[model samples]
Target chain A: MKNFVWLLAVSVSLSGCQHPSLAYITNQGDSTVSVIDAAQQTVTHTITVGKAPVGVAVSKELQRIYISNVEGQSISVIDSQTLAVTETLSIQGSPVGVALSPNSQTLYVADWYSDRILAIDTSNTKIQREVIVDKAPAGLVVSPDNKTLYVAARDSNQIVAIDTQSLTIQKRIDVGVHPFGVSLSADGKHLYSVNVYDNSISMIDLKDVEAKTHSIKVGEHPYCAMPNSDNTKLYVSNTQDDTVSVIDLNTRKLISTIKVGMTPEGLDYDARNHQVLVANWGTNDVSVIDARTDKVISTIKTGNQSRAFGQFVMQ
Target chain B: MKKLLTIIALAALSFNAAAHGPSPQKVEKTIVIKAAPAKVWAVVKDFGNMHAWHPAIASTKLEKKGDETFRTLTLKDGGTIYEKLRTADDADMKLRYEIVDGVAPVADYNAFMQVTAGPGAGESTVTWVGRFYRTYKLNPPIPAGQDDETAVKFVTGVYDSGLANMKKVIENSK
Candidate 1:
């Protein structure tokens, strides 16, 4: 009787530890979002989204995921628990990049064609405001304090910072040519932009906004960058080279280039699993790399043209 | 003169319709040959002898600068393409290359070619796949011959003809 009770206790503990975290990947070719269970490393569900879904963001507080569909000109709000798209919000321009506020109350989307950033109220699913920026705004990230938002204007080759409360442009910092993705450090002390045409990364020191930009050369046509939780390392995905360039934040130099799937575009760091999930557009799969070792440990196949451009993993 | 003008207008309209965005397009072509995987890989991995297998390639010149290797291929139609070798893995029987400068109606072209074992014994399959975007990497008012359709058609024609001719040559050699 005691052995049976102990066995029951073990089973309950195992079940409690198995709570799954999901990585939402947006497949552009087939218009679907693949929900991957990070613990099990398998695709748990495939939810149909709008046409050409490119960007994805998750709200942990609300238990929801927002996907921006470029061709459909809408955003698909997915319920994280149900694994279904609960609402589809139609916006005006071509929506590509997406981000959520710190409190998960407001969602920011970058419209590429219209050159504007649309702020949507998450509660009502309506456009709260629009801030017009430079041409071809692509990637966006919200500050940790929820005060500043950085926008990567691809055509203008500059990073624009906006005041979240005032809904106005705060600063326009010049970067490399054709910057596509922008990321902030954990402490919000640094900003990095992946320059597509220049094949480099512009590292902007937030404290010294007026100083000259520091450019770190990388592989060809880098698309996006994601810093680790500790801000010690930065991983940038080079699309044309099919490799991930790992940069050491202390030295600000490329430490290694790990080969991954073809046309690797979007990248996100899974803090719970200590792995970086890379969306390979050409190969239609997600390459998960072991962050500790900086090696590709496994490749999970997804729908065609997997491009999860924004914050996708929900811990 | 009226009929010619009408044809030109239709062509322009078709080009405009296909220039949707700067989305990456893919082209894949596969062919089976009556040869072993090793034999097929020998031909595919030879970075300098593409003219021997591909009928469209008139000549190939290989050059080495620093630690990088490059090949300049002269097409039969008088067009030239410059490519750089990225990776060649003998164990995987796979090679990857990228077009540095080319006459094709595509930009940022990268390709992978692999040789694998076929269903039957002494048979092999060669697959060539490429991902690229149209030369006009921006939205609309796209110039002629640089639209998405033109890039797709040009790449597809290149892969199809090359793979078909490769099958013929390998089978004939055996």
Candidate 2:
């Protein structure tokens, strides 16, 4: 009786809502988003999206995922419970990056070709606001506090910060050549910007009146950088070298580099599972690495030219 | 009645030939850069340094017939592009040339690049244009099953990326 009870408990935990979440990878070339089961270390589902999906974001409170299709100029919203596209939001120009509010009610999309930021109300699937920013904006992230939004300007080589409430540009900081991905620390104290051409990640102190900028070297053509849940480690995707360089934030040094697939792009660290999910653009696979050991535990084939991946909790 | 029917058949064959000419033999992509007219004139006039700005040509060898024209073999696509520099314009900053012989994908292609002063007095507008036709056919050795349109599309993608890269360099500098 005890043995049966123990098995029941384990199976219940595995299917629990608090169970380690799945990561959705957007494959640009294949027009599909792959869902990776963190516990199994394998792909459980591949959902079809619009053509050339580039960026992905997930909502913890709403239990939903958003994918931005660059060529289709739309966002496909997937419900976590059903794992189906619940809605599609059409926006102007080529939507490249997407971010969801902490409350999961709002989504911010960056239009790369149009140089604009679109605010979408998730519940209604309607455009709330259209904010214009620097030229060729790509990467996007909403603050933990849901106060400020950060965007990477690809052609302008700068990072634009906007106040979410006012929907106004608060500041613009100069970065390296072709800044692609931008992320803010969990506490919203530091802003990290990845410059693709310069192959470096710039760390900016946002708390101080005079922002102090520091840079750490990474692999060739560094494309994206994201912080761990604890904000202690940063996983950076090196597109040309096809590796993920793990950086120790406290020591400000590269501790290790894990080989992934051909030309890796987007990356996110799953806090619950302690696994780093990497999107390999060239080989069309998603690699999950054990965050504790910095080693690849498994690789799940996604699709050709997989670009971005994200994870969130189900409310 | 027989004579009239024969005349109609001849007319139909002529119309068919006019509508569908022989499939284009090959397709190719070429680039041209604009330098200061007088200064760029002499440099581009020589076939020796063709690799400097042109994307595909790795190198070049010149067999000069005179000061105005030269027979050149461009090291592009495994040393297959051969063209004759027919005219070099000093005032207009233009290069007009013809594909004399080559293994480029598109056949019967003529291209040119003309650099003219922009709206602003100091700046210049470089216009690059090419006209070519493509045909889909099988290789003789392969028993005529291969389609050539796929090859044309592949070359087009390469040229598109190359042009984007070239424009980035040129516009960023100016």
Candidate 3:
């Protein structure tokens, strides 16, 4: 009877530790990452990272998180299980944006100052190669097929697609002025670039590369974009306006603008809860919006200068 | 040869210093007026009549479009500024707006004005705050008028003068 009671107590404790999902937010000012449990809507751990961590990417299959520290000029790798920084890979130039391959075996770091992209082997965390591209690469996205990589070259005002195998530039499509964030539809048929200076989004049809791009006007100083699971809607964070502009993919027009916290920069779509998580830089909090209603449901406080640029939610 | 080398070194250092990217900045100013909080709120919340209280604003024109209110302010120097009213809450005595287009040497400008009861009876405190980035968004060698310092100075001057004049107008009236 005593053994059975101890066993039951252990099982109950272990079950409580299991979290359905986690959202990792990079706090630029504090140089730390706040890990929030989606189920509980609370920050479970705050892991110390390098200086000015702005970009974040997670590999659910591998259970690892990659953070780009722009000022520190390095990438801090965290094991999702341990919720700790396992290693830091130093790269020259200012590393601002990051993405991982579909297989979670390779990592891509965009160096804004160096004007190039560095590919690292994820297993060993070693610099595999570097591909030189346009000026000031700020955002990155991998194709669903995992064959191409799209980069938002801010200064050059273009999106450059690279062949992953060859690690060479495949296509250069002209976009709006100072495009900073890039995203793709769930089917990978359309590509979107958030243009900061023009306060617009450039929608590129991937099926026909030469097709004229459609520019949709959004709020001021838009930083990043995230598409829904079904590609029916797109959400963008306008930093200066402090609002999220909802775009209907069918009409390709602005449907609504939801007010958020100050300096909303990075955003991601959570498939499980069907919510959008936005990192507010000035307010030091995360605003969770209900995708169905397009309204802010809750605001969870994080560290200072939160900018979780890339895909931060662990599926 | 030595003089030429010194000039080259100085130019390189300045260029390097100017190449840093623009960072967001804030400017805030507060004034204590003898008027009551309700009186101060009335003047501040009138989004269309900024020229009446602000010394620098020469004229103001208000327009409404698609459920949004916009105001155009002509400054004393003949420069004009276009702003959109984001929110106005009477209960909180707070008004928020953003610059749509302007000649203020700043980009992505958002401002807030609030009026509250002061330490003394019948006295009110008014505060004006603005957050903005430099007009030049791209990586610098920023131009003379579009640098971070220029943006900060322009916003500071606007807030300082506007609040000072607002206090004078509110206190002197009635």
Candidate 4:
């Protein structure tokens, strides 16, 4: 019995080593996705997709990575382990932002030009339903409980929440102008929207709907945001300013601002590696920020025009 | 809100509509000028007097509204370009600007000019960088004058001529 327990522990750690964290950086200019292994700090594969790949949704359980090709009007599904494009789903409109449900059964795609949200069945690759929301639907995030999917309506200046099960609009929460990137806390207790034009972040309380939403001022022309695992802080990438604003969530104050590459766009928190991977659109590089120190430790050059819009890290 | 709708509708229907592109473009050009860092920066920092150095500009008009400063440049090619001054840091010898609206075949154009000490004595390197998107953003069959190549070529030409003339003007002076 004692030997069996020791063997089980060894096997568990072996599985963990086999599956290192990976970051999928969608390069829009080159129309390819750079799959980087976090442990090695290098790209393992460069999978070519359709034209203008902008968004990424990684599913660890399903072992798949879905990439939205805005100009190609399709989604390229890549096998996470094999690093190969297995299938391509033809979308009707231009797909920009993409998200996966907690259960990984439904993939939500925000069509930027069509102003609609598409719920594609994961197992079959068929779009189960689509609903027209506003002028432009850009960012999307599903709740931890898999009950709600929030989308940022860019031109309408609102965050629209839709019921995942019923596939219906629940609430149109007004946010700052040009809210382009939307994210939810790990615990699903708060929602943050990055207003590109307003240069601010809106934090909405999910536990208490009656609570007043708080708006935190950030740098110029903020693009995307990501929250730490503990929900104690938030990081926003300021595109125009070429910096990242670190916000202390408890006090709702700016903690620090770190300068990065020009036109930093997509950002994702790597919990396993305790790092933040930022895609620099202008410099075509990935700036890796150490979450503990809030400093850029290294920068890995990627394809031309890297904009990993959605959650790209798979732990 | 209604005005925003009107703007969108007009942009969609206009023949040479200025829509956004899927991929962003960048152009960075550098020239080693035989001058001090501060001296070269003085020419770049004089945002209102670009026509003095750049041959493509016929004249420049500077206006200030509240805390914001704007400049209108009348091109020698019989066109005009409006731009806003973002920042001018004397310490770093860097100036940042953005195009408000112009005949340039680009949208959301943001640029910066920086002067740094060069590899040789009594010399400074000037770097001009521009980031923007093509005016026509839709998928295929882009307009002749609004595609990515056209936009990049136009901006490249502008930078080449302006930098060459600025070099000649600065080097020949004194």
| Candidate that would win on lDDT | 4
- The collision pairs in model 3 are none
Model 1: DockQ against the native? 0.14
Q: Sort by lDDT, best first: what order? A: 4, 1, 3, 2
Instruction: Give the TM-scores of the predictions, in the order they appear.
Output: 0.80, 0.65, 0.74, 0.91
Tell me the tens digit of each residue's lDDT in model 3 across B1-174: 232222222221111111124235667788899998999999999999999988777899999999999999987666677899988889989998988875666676788898989879888998887877665544334577566667777777777777888888887889
Task: Show the lowest summed lDDT stretch of 10 residues, model 1 chain B.
Answer: B11-20
Residues B49-107, candidate 1: write the lDDT tens digits.
Answer: 89988877889999999999999998776667889998888998998898887566677
By TM-score, the best candidate is 4
- Please identify which of the two predictions, 3 or 4, would achieve the higher DockQ against the true structure: 4
Location of the lowest summed lDDT over 10 successive residues in candidate 4 chain A: A204-213
- C-alpha lDDT score of every prediction, in listed order: 0.86, 0.69, 0.85, 0.87
Per-residue lDDT of candidate 3, residues A1-315 (tens digit): 999999999997776455467899999878999999775778989999998898898997788999999767789999998988899998777788999988988899998777899989998876478999998888999998899999999888999999999999999999999889999998889999999989999999988867758999999889999999999999999987789999999899999999999889999998888999999987889999999999998999999879999999986
Model 3 / residue A81 / CA error / Å: 1.9
True contacts kept of 4: 0.18
Q: Each candidate: how many clashes?
A: 0, 5, 0, 0
Residue pairs clashing, model 2: B26-B105, B26-B106, B26-B107, B27-B105, B27-B106
Candidate 3 CAPRI level: incorrect
What is the Å distance of residue A218 in model 2 from its true position?
0.9
Model 1 steric clash pairs: none
